[model samples]
Target: MRRARVGIDVGGTFTDFVLSNGADGSLTYFKEPSVPSDPSLAVERGMAALLDRARLEPGDVELVVHGTTLGLNAIIQRRGAAMALVVSRGNRDVLEIARCRMPSSYDFSAPKEEPLVPRDLVFEIGARSAFDGTILARPPVEEIAELAETLKSRGVAAVAVMLLNAYVDPTLETEVADALASRLPGVLVSRSSQVWPEIREYERALVAGLNAYIHPLLERYYATLTRRMGELGVAAPLYITASNGGALSVDSARARPIDTVLSGPASGVVAAARIALLTGRQEIITFDMGGTSSDFAVSKGGEPEYTTRTDVGEFPLILPVVNVSSIGAGGGSIVRVDKHGVLKVGPESAGADPGPASYRRGGTEAAITDCYVAAGIIDPDAFLGGRMKLDRAAASGALERVAQRLGMTGEDRAAQAAEAALSVTTAKMATELFKGLAQRGLDPRGFALIPFGGAGPTHANLLAEEARLAAIIVPPGPGTFCALGAIMADVKRDYVRTVRRRLSDDGAPQALAATIAGLEREATDWVGSEGAIVEATQLSAEADMRYAGQAYELHVAIPAALGKTMAAREVGELFHQAHERLYGFRDVDSAIEVVTLRVRVVGRVPPIAIPELDKTATAVEPKGRRRVFHRGQWLDVPVFLRDRLVQGQGFAGPALVEQEDTTTWIIPGWHARVDAVGNLHVSRG
Candidate 1:
C-alpha cells in the first residue's frame, strides 16, 4: 500500500500523467487523448489509467499536482467570459491607448491588439487618487449603485475595478471593489491594487481584468476536477502549477487564474532547471516540443531566467514568469503548400479534436507527425505502445496531395515532401533558437540541448545540427516530462511593488527599507497560505535598478540581510555588478536608482531523486531495422527498444531508439550512450 504522488499536465493533444511512489522510488508515465471541450475529463481519465497501471488504489494518492493551458487558451482565443473594466473617470481608454506605441513602430498598417474589455463595456467611476497615495475623490454611493446596475444590464460576467493611482494606496480601491462585489452578487469583482499593486496603471488594470476574465471558467473547472477526484476515492491535496514555475493550492489558483496562464510550459522548464542543478549541467537549453508548439528555455548556473515583461499573445503580462520562448512548430502543426506552391508548416495547430492525419480521428490535413511517419522518424504501428495504431496509408495519402500540388509524381514524392517539411520545421526552430540566445549573448555551441516532450527528442539531433550545437541529452520519459515538472515544482508565489527613487535621494534609503519591509511582510503571509502543505520554505529578493536617467532597469539580487535597510552604497555596487554581467561594461561612477522591488517565495517540496539503472555487461541488441530517409536517400537504420538498454551501454549513429512515449534519432557521424540516470546522450563522433 504505497502512497503515490501524481503530476498531470493537460496539453492541446494529450493529457500526460506521471506517478511516483516514494516507497520504492518507482515512476510510471501515461498519456490520454485530450478532450478539448472539457480538459478536466481527459485529466481524470489519464489519472485513472495511470493509477491502475501502477497497481495503486486511488486512496493511496497523497498529493496531485496539475498544470493546464486553459487560461492561456482563453486569453489567446479571446473566448473568456465577458468582463467589464471599471476605471477612473479619465482613464476609460487605458487598454486602447496602451504604452502609446505600436508593437512595430514603423508599420502603421499593423493591426492593433484587441482589447480585453470592449470600449462600450468600459465604465468610468468618479473615484480618484493622487500619485502620492492621497485620495482626492471617492465614488459617490449613488454613482456606484448606478454603475452596478449598468453592469448588470450589460450582463458582464465579471468586473475589474481600477481606480487611478490606487497602487500607491489600496485602501480606497479595496473598499470600492468590496462594495461593488456585494452589489453584483454573483459577478466576480477584482481590484487592480488587490491583484498586483504595481505602479503602471494599464498593466495593473490588465492583471485585474485578466483575473476577472478567467475566474468563472477556472472555478467551474476546479469544481468538476475536485468532484471527479473525490468520486475516485482519493482525498489527496490538489495543487495547480503557476506561470512562475511553482505550484499553488487549488483555492489560490481559483482566485488568481491569470497566474496559471503559462502553467503548462512553465512546468517543463522547471523540471529541466531541476535536472540541470542536480546533474551539474548548469548551462543547458530545455527544448519542449508538444502538440501545438515547441518552446525552449535557457537555464544557466542551475536556474532558469525570470522576466516580468513577457507577452501573452499581443497582451503584455507584467508578472514574473519563467521565460520560455516559443521556437518551433509542433507535431500537430499542419503541413501545406501555399498559393505559390511554397511549402509551409504552421503557427496554427490541428489540436486534439481531429489531431493529425495519422490519428485517424477525422483529420484530413497532413501534419508534422504525419511527416515523421512518412519519413520514418516515428513508427506508425508502434505509436503509443500500439494502443492506438496510426494510419500510415492515410498519412501518406494526405501528404501525397501536397506532393501532387508540387507537381511531383513517384513513390519517393511523399517522402521527399515529408523530408522537406521536416527540414522547414527544423530550420525555423534553429533560427529562433539562435536569435533567442543572441538576446542573452549565449552561444549554441557552448550549451547542450536537453529535449523532452513527444517530439523534442525526435527532432533534437536535427535541431542541434542546424543550430551548430555539439551535443544532446534525451531524458527518459520525455513526453511526460511536463507532468514530472509539475510534481517537481515547489509551492511558490511572487510579490512586486514600485519604488521609483534614486539611491542618492535624501530619504531614499528609509523609503526603500519601508517598501521592502512591506513587500516582505505580504510575501511571508501569501507564501504561507500557498505552502500550507509544505514543511520548509525558501525566499529570494531582487530589486529592479538602473543608472540615473536610464530608460530601462535591470534586476539585481539583494541579500536577505539587506531587507531592513540596505546600505545605499552596497546596493549601488550590486546594481553595477549585475550591469557588468548583462552589458559588456558598467559605469562605476554613475548614480544608481532602484525602480521596483520583487520577492519570490518558494515552499520546498521533498525532492524525488532519479534512481540509477543497473550497469550493463554488454551492448543492448537492436529490436529491428527500418528504412529511414536521410539526406536524399533511404538507409536501413538499427532500431532499439529504449527499455532494453541499461546504464553504461553504448550505441552508434544511424539508430532509432523507440520508447512508449517518443523516439530518439541518432544521426550519422554521431554516437550515443546511456548514462547512470538512463538518459541517452548524443555527441559528435
Candidate 2:
C-alpha cells in the first residue's frame, strides 16, 4: 500500500492538482476548467478527478496542501464582510487620513483606493497613550460595554480595535477585545497589537480591519475544505501556503487569513527557487504567467526576497511576505486596438468563461495566447494534449482585424502584429521587473529566468531576452508548479515590536531589554503552537533605526544576544557602521534612534528533494516538425518530447521542447541540456 501527498492550486482560469506517490516518488497532474463563480466546486471536482486518474484511494493520502487566491480576489473586487473599526478617541478618521500622500503626482484624475472601512461604521472610544508609552486616558468600563452594544445593534459583521501606542502595552487592548467577544458572540473581533505589533497607527489598524473584513469568507472556505478532506478519509494534518513563501497549519491560517492572500504566486517563486538549487543555479527570477495575470519574483541563493509593506489589493499588510509582483498580462488577457490606433493588451481579461478567441468559447477578441497560436509557437492540434482544440482561424481573424488597423497584409504581417501586441505586454512586465529590482540593487544578468504557468515557458525566453538575463530553466510540469510549491512550503510565522530608543546602553538600556524580551516571548508562543515542525527554530532579529530627527528609518540586523554583554558604546558603533554600509554615509556626531524591532520565527518542514530522473539508454526523439515564426521569418522547428529527454542529453536551438504540461522553445544560437533532476537548462552560445 502506497501513501500519497496531494497539492492543489486554484487559478482564475484553471484549477490544477498534483498527486505524488510517497512510496515510488511518482507524480501525476490534472487540470480542470475553473468555475470562478464557486471556486470550491472546481476544487472538489478536480480532487476527485485527479484521485481517479492517479488510481489512488483518497484514504491513502497522508497530506493535502492547498494555495488559493480567494481573499485576494475578494479584497480586489471589494466583496467581503461589512466591518466596523474601533479607534482611540480623537483619531476617528485614521483610515480616511492614510499617509495624506497621493499615489500619483501627475494624474489628477487618478483616485486613491477607497478605505475598506467606511466612515459611519467607524466608532471611537476614549483610549489614549503617548508616544513615550505613558497613559493619557482610558475609557470607563461602562463606556466600552455601551460601545460594544452599539456595534452589535448597528449590524457590523466584525470589529477592529486600534489604539494609540497599543504596541507598547496590549493589556488594555485585550480587555476591550474580551468585552467585545462577550457582548457580540458571533461578530469577529481583532486587535491591531495582536495582528501586527508595529508602529504607525493607520497602517497597523488597516491590517487588523482587513483581516476582519475577509474573516468570515475565509473561515467558511477553510471549513468546507477541511470537511471535504475528511469525507475522503484523509486524516493527515492539512497545511496552507502563506504569502511569506511558507506554509501554516489550518488553525493558524484561519486565524490570520490576510497572511495567505498572496500565497498562490509566492508558491511558484518558492518552487522556482527549489528547482534552481537542484540545477546548481544561485540567482534566479521566476516568471509565472497564468490565465488572467502574470507575476515575477527574484531569488538569490535559493531564498526569495521578502517585503514587510506589500499591498493586498487596495490595502497594505504589515507582515512580511515573499515579494511577488503581478501585472495584467496572461493567456486570457484580451487584446484590442484602441480608437487612437494604438494596440493594448490588457488591464482587462476575458477570464475563463470567454477565455481567448482561440478557446472558441464565445470570445472574439485577440489575446496573448491567441498570438502564440497565430505565430505557430503553440500547436493547435496538441493543446492540452488535444483535450481542447483551439480555433486557429478565429485567432488569425482576430489578429487580422488588428492588422488591418495597422494597414498590413499576409500571414507574415499578421504574425508581426500579434508579436507586436505581445511585445507591448512583455515590455510592460520588463519595466516593472527593472524598477522592482533596482530598489534592491539587483541585476537581471545575474539571474536565470524560470517560467511556469499556462504560458510561462512560451513567454520566458522573450522576457529573458528583453530583461538581458543570462539563462532560462524550464522545470518539469511547469503549469502545475504552484501546486508543487504548495506541497513544498514549510510551516512558519513572523513577529515584530516597536522600540523607540537610542543605541547607547545608558540612554536606552531599559527599552532595548524590554523590546527584545517581548519579541522573544511572542516568537516562543508562536513556534510552540507549531509543534514538532519546529524541532529547532531559527530567529532573525533586526532594528528599524535612523539618525535623530530623520523621518525615514533603515532596517539593521542586530545580534540576538546583544542584550547580555554588549556595552552601550559598542552597540552605538554597530549602528554607525551598519548605517554607512546602507546609505553611503554615517552620522557619527549625530544621535541614533531605534524606531522598531523585528523577529522572524521559522518552522522547518522536512525537505522534499527533487526526484532523480532515470538515465536509461534511450534517445529522446522529436514528435514532428512545425513552422514557427521567429526573427522575421518562418522556420521548420523540431518539437521534442520532454519526458523522453534523459539526463545529460544536450540539444541545440531552433527546437520546441514539448511536455505533457508545457512547451519550452530553444531559440537560435541557444543550447539546452537536461540535468539529473530533469530540468531543461537553456543558455546562449
Candidate 3:
C-alpha cells in the first residue's frame, strides 16, 4: 500500500486506530489502553503499533485525523483554564439569570449549576450594539484599559467578551476585546460573534466562555500529540474531527476547541450515515457503546440529525452538533446494587486504569465487561486476542457482592446477577432510545440498529430484541468504527444570528436578506481559511421561526440558491412547511417571527475507499464453540473468527463472531450474513 492515512479516536477506556492504505483500499485496526492522565501517550503508542501492524513506514503516512472527547470532558468536569467573562453593562447577571428558567421548576431542592465564570470574575462595560447592527455605545478606552489591568492582576488565562446584542454586529465587541487583549498581552481572548454569534445572550456568552475555558487545555494536548507524531518521523498533516461530523484544520481546532466537544460521537454517527448511503438503509440508529458511556444517534435518509440546542453537562451548547444521546452504561461502567437492593449498572465507570473487574487489573467492582464475562458473551481467554488475560472468577466474585445484596443464592448466583445487570442496562438503553426517537415522532421498529464500539456488538442483539428493532448491522471493524469515521469527516462550521422581526412587516424581508448575506460572507471566509484540503465548499441556510404567539421556534431550511434575493413570502412558506412536517399541521394565517438565522459551511474532503471483501474465497468453518448463558440457561454456541468470514457467508442462531476488538452475538432466531463490504447484517429469521 502507498500513501497511507490514519484515523485515531481516543475513547475513555481505549484509544482506537484505523490505518487506510491508499494503494489497495485495505484497512488495519489496532487499539491501546487509554491513559486518562496523559491521553496523548496512548495516541503515540497506538500510532506506532498501527504502523507496525499495517507494515507501513511512518514516512508513508500522508494524513492523520483524530477525534477526542477531552474538551467535552474538561467542560463537564469543570477542569479547565481560569477564565473571565466580559459583558455589556447592566447584564452582569445574564449568566446567572439564564432565561429565568431552573432545571426543574418543581424541584425546590435542586441546586443551580455554578456558572463557569463566577459573578466576581464577570466584568461589564458599556460596549453595546442595537438589533440592526448599529453601535449603541462603546466601552470607554479608559474603562477597557482598567478591566484589562484587573484581568491581568487576577491572573486569568483567557477572556470572553459578549456585549448586549453583539450578534447585531461584532465590530464593537471585537474592537473592545482587541483593546483589552493589548493591555493583557498573553491571555487568549474570544468574542461571542467570533465564536457562535447566536442570539439569546446567555447561550451566546456561554459559547464564548466555554471556548475560552477549554482552549489552553486542548491546545496543550494538540501540541503534545503533534510533537510526538513529529518525533515518530511522521510528516502527515494532522486534522481534528468536529461536532458537526466533519474535520477541521489543526489551526481551527487550536483556536476553537468548543467545536470538537461532541466530535467523537459525531464521527461514529457520520460513519453510520455513510454506511446507510452505501447500503440503502435510510432509517438506522447508530449504537456507539464505548468504555464510559454508550451513545445513540439516529440517521434518516442517510444523514444524522443535527441540533443546536444541545448541552455539555449542565451548560447549554448552541453550536450545531450531530444529535447523539448518551446511555449511562458502557463496557467500563460499574455495576452495583442500589440502596433499594435493585441491581444498577452505572452512572460511573472504572475507566481504563482499573477498567473492568475481568481485566485482571486492581479493580474489585464489577463492570459491564465483567457481566459479559460472567454471562460467557465474551471469551475470557480471547479478550483483546488474549494479549491481556481476564479472570472470570474475579468477575464472578465481584458480581457476588451485588448478588448477595440482592438476596440471591445458588451456584449460578453471580450469573443471575450479571444477567439482571445486563437486563437493567438494556432496558435503560431501550427506554432512552424510545424517548429520543419519540421526540422526532419516530418508532424504533422502523429503524435498524447499527452497533459499533468495544462492546456494542456483543450487546446489540439484546438491545434490539428489547427495543423491538427490525435488525442489526455490525460494521466490519466495529471496535474501531469511530476511528474509521474520523477519516471520512469534512471541514465544517456553523454560524447563527437572531433576527427578531415579524415576517409580515414590510422592512423585515430586507433586514432578513441583509442578515443572511452577512452570515454567508462570514461562513465563506471561515470556510476559505479551513485549509486546502477542502476541495469544494457548500452552504446550507436555515432560519428558526415561530408563529407570532408560539413559545418555541421551528427551524426551517432555506434554499442556498436563493441567496440574498430571498423574499418574505418564501421564508414564511418554508417555516410553514417545516412546522407541518414536525407537528402534522401548519397555521398559514398566523403571523411568523424570524427568531434566528443559521448558516452551515461544509468543506468537502476527498472520500476514503473501503476495502471490498475477497469474494472468491471458499466457505469458512466454525473456529470453536463456547457455552454461553442465554434465556436463563447455558448452551453451547458456535464461535467463528471474524477475519475468516467471507462475502455472502451466512450463519444462524446463537453464534459468536470473534474479532480482536469485539464480538458480535447472533441471538437465537436471528440470522447473520456478510455483505460485499464484510458488514455483518443480522435480522430475525
The TM-score measured for candidate 2 stands at: 0.95
Instruction: Tell me the spans in candidate 1 whose CA falls farther than 4 Å from its real position.
Output: 584-590, 616-618
> What TM-score, over all chains together, does every model reach?
0.98, 0.95, 0.97
Residue-level lDDT tens digits of model 2 in 100-195: 878799988888878889899899998887776677887898998899888978988888899888998887788778788888888999898888
Find the 10 residues in a row with the least total lDDT in model 3: 560-569
**Cand. 3 Cα-lDDT:** 0.89
Which lDDT tens digits does candidate 1 get at residues 11-127?
888889999898788889998988989888888888889989999999889899999998888888988998999998989999999889886889989988788899999889888
Give the C-alpha miss distance for residue 587 in model 1, angstroms: 4.8
lDDT of 1: 0.88
For each candidate, the alpha-carbon lDDT, in order, equals 0.88, 0.83, 0.89
- C-alpha displacement of 393 in model 2, angstroms? 2.4
Q: Cα lDDT for residue 6, model 3? A: 93
Backbone clash tally (model 1): 0
Measured on C-alpha atoms, candidate 2 has an lDDT of: 0.83
Ten residues in a row with the worst lDDT in model 2?
Answer: 563-572
